[model samples]
Target: MQINQTQSDGLKQAFSVTLPFADLEQKRQARLVELGRTIRLPGFRPGKVPMSLLQKRYGSAVMAEVADESVNEATRQLLSERGLRPAMQPKVDLVSAGEDKDLEFTLELEVLPEIEVPNLGEITLTRLKAEPGDEAITQGLDNLLKSRRKEIEVTEERPAAQGDAVVVDFVGRIDGVAFEGGTAQDVPVELGGAGFIPGFAEGIDGISVGETRTIKVTFPAEYGSAELAGKDAEFEITAKGLKQFETPVADDALATELGFEDLEDLRKFIKDRLQRELDSEARQNIKRQLLDALADRISFAVPPSLSESEFTQIWNRLEEEKKAGRLDDADKDKDEDTLKAEYRAIADRRVRLGLLLAEIGQKNGITVSNEELNRAIFQHSMMYGARQQEALDMFRKNPQAAEFLRGPIFEEKVVDYVLELAKVEDKPVTAEELAAAVAADAEG
Candidate 1:
């Protein structure tokens, strides 16, 4: 056996490997002997086949098997001897493999780049802190009460006004033809309230009971349904009745109705829940700052294969968004070349950061425990509601599906580990301010 380094560039390496025909013949002979021990030939007893006939019958098949094993073995030996970690599967090009000839192949692969873990203590980040105030709790309770508000039918004949609910039958047509999901009967629509197409609720603002009117509206450019987006449509609406909401007072009775012991208990629960949400947002903000700091401090060449894979995933998603007319505003004005360059840079950064985090986790012996992974899986399954058991069973049966959860858990743990070591200063702010900060970070 022999090996030669054919090429070396950045993170890519290629090698030529050759196995002498003598070694191939030896392996073939050994395999033939093993098969002979369990063989039964016509006109011969078991394990008594002649060596010449055995070779004649299985020589080609045995040699092919030997060639495959030799290539794999040689590749493994090459990687081990060279201390090379591949970024992806190595490409094998069989150069030569014929009877009584030396086996030869070329191995091409992009190796994982060496990553230098930065000093965690040197990284600086500010964690925004926010807590739900008494006013916030009161507002939350008010919102809850509104959700549970009852509608009282108006007895007197009158026109629907703002904050009033109106029952109506309507059919919408686009370009003079009715479309699917554009017609409904006896639907309760809240005047001046959300969840209606723009101008729809306002169009019915002055509609009186038993009145029929035709309202014209143009769907927003970013409407969810692509077919109706930016299209002008007319709705023929027939008002059925008028109703108003009976707003409930946020008192003990209301709390008990919502499954709480008392109003105070409900307020405490709301505050606690709000605090948890703020804490989650705060952690995310600080983690982003820490990652940005680390990315700035550390720099290394990422494997092109990894960057390309990440870019491909990002570009595919962008294409889907473009097709759905949901492309980001920032990217909408950019040409194909500009978008590709910008997203390619993002892909490179992601791969580089991923490698850095992995290196840090490896060096610090950070790992996700089985219990933590199970808890994460259980939480994920809970998202499926009644099908939670089915989701759990699927994860249990499909290791690959469950393995997808491992990366997030591991990355979070790594981030937590870094946070523990980094100098993270807590800055108290209002919930609105914290939200604005997060939004700003996301926009950049």
Candidate 2:
């Protein structure tokens, strides 16, 4: 066997390999011998079958198998010898081969790029620190009380107020014909709540019980149903009843009703939960900031294959957002050229960061153990609820699925390890402030 290797680009390499006829003949002879040891065919006892007959019948099949294995083996050996780590699978092509000559093939692949992870000790980042605060907790408690609130029958025979809940039957039509989900009977509507279109809920206000009226509203331009989007519709409604919220007081009674012992205990539990939520958000914010900082410090030719993949992922997401009108106004402000340039830069950053993390992990011998993989599989399984065992079985049965699980786990571990080396400082801030910081980072 002969091997020749050369680089095509920063991360791409080409390998040409040739295997001698002697090796092919040896494999063919071995295959025939193995077949001779097996059971009888209809014409003769299998062990008594001649080697010439075995070669005549299975020679082509065996040769193809041997050729494939030979290419795969050579590719593996080349990677081992050169220490080249591919981002994805290596592509192999049969360069030249004949019935009884040298078997030849070429391998084309984008190897993982070499990266110098910089300034681990001097890199600065700040993790946002926050508690939900008194205002937020009070709002949360008020929400719970509101959830327990019921619609009490209105005593006064007067028009409905803005905050009043109305029980009504309504039939809405566009072009004088009803649409799906546009008709309902005895539905409860809280006036001024996030119900229906912009003016739909407000139109229900000031209607007294037993009144019948037509409420006209227009669907927004960005509505989900394309046919009905921006269309005007009139609803024929019969106001059956009017009611007001009867909220439960925050006391021991409310706690017992909520399956808790006392209001104080409930508040304490809620406060602790809220604190953890804020801290989780803070940690996530810091993680993104650190990634962005690391991206800024690095510049190298990302493996073109990975850059294309990253670009596709980001661009696909952007397309979805654009179609849904969910892209932020700031994003809309930029022209397509500008947006592409900015996002391309982002794709490059992500590819570079991925390369950096992988190189660092490899250099430090960071790897996911079998125990870690099993645990990850178990946790991922639990995400599917009662089918967890079935999902776990799937992971255990499929090597690729299990390997996919390792990538994220390893990535997170590497991020944590890098954070330890970086000069990350705690920055106490309000929820709004932290949100602003993230928003600003996103805008840039």
Candidate 3:
């Protein structure tokens, strides 16, 4: 076996590997022996098949398999000997191959940067002191109660009006053709809700029970259904009932229905939940400040390869945003040099911080444990309204998906460890001050 470096860049290595024919033949024969033991034929016994027959039947497949193994082995050996780590999978090209001739291939890989992490103690950061107040908790509780409040039927002979919810059956038509999701039966729609088309809901106002009417509406130009956009449609409606707004009183009885002992218990729960949110936000702010300070503390330049990848990712996003006319107002006015300098700086900082956190995690033996992974999986499932078992199965069946759950856990643990040694001061500041400080750091 021989490996020769054909080209070298800052963080890229291109190598050509050659294995003598003798070694190739050895691996091929070994594979053939294994195949013969398991392979059965009508005429040949499983374990007693002739080597010539095996070679004739499975030689090409065995050769390809051995070549793949050889490439993997040679690449691993090369990386280990040179103390290099690949940033991504190496691209392997089979340059030459034959039954009796030596095997030859070329491997190209982007190597991980050689990063020297700065001392954590030297890093400076600030953490804001804040917690959700009673007012916020009360507001949140009110919102929850409102969402769960039920609407009851109104027994009145008056005509349906705006701000009233009317029970009706309606059908919509576009160019005399009814499309999917264009009609509803006995549906309750709030007059002037702006939920339905502009004129459709208003036409329901002053409608009487058992009354049938035709309402016309023009779909918005940017409606999701392209075929209906900027088109006129008629909804034939028949009102069956009406309802008036009713909010439950904020009392102990209402709280009991919400699975709580009383209103006070509910308020306590809300306060606790709000405090957790505030604490999480505080941690995030500290982490951002810590990252920025760490970037300033580091002195070495990031590997050009890593920086290029990072910059390219950010640059591509900016281009996409520009095309959509969604570029930030502040960024829109900036010149190319200014934008490049700002974004390149951001890319450099992110790469440096990522490299530093990875090194720290490795040195401290920090790992993504199963418990943390389950928590991540559970949270992700909650985002999509999924059952716990369903999300777990999704993660377990897809190794790549499970791997995605690991990175954040590892990074968070490393951040916590660094914060332990870091000079993170709890500078008591108002919400406005904290927001300004975080925004300034983001701009930088």
Which candidate comes out best when scored by lDDT? 1
**lDDT score of residue 199 within candidate 3:** 85
lDDT of 1 by residue, 347-386 (tens): 9999999998888899989988889889989999999999
Q: Could you tell me the lDDT of residue 388 within candidate 3? A: 66
Ranking by lDDT: 1, 2, 3
Residue-by-residue lDDT tens digits, candidate 2, 56-81 = 88888888888888888888888898
Superior candidate under TM-score, 2 versus 3: 2
- TM-score: which is higher, 1 or 2? 1
The TM-scores of all predictions, comma-separated, are 0.91, 0.86, 0.76
lDDT of 2: 0.84
1 versus 3: better lDDT goes to: 1
Q: At residue 301, what lDDT does model 2 achieve? A: 73
Better of 1 and 2 by lDDT: 1
TM-score of 2: 0.86
RMSD of each: 2.5, 3.3, 5.5
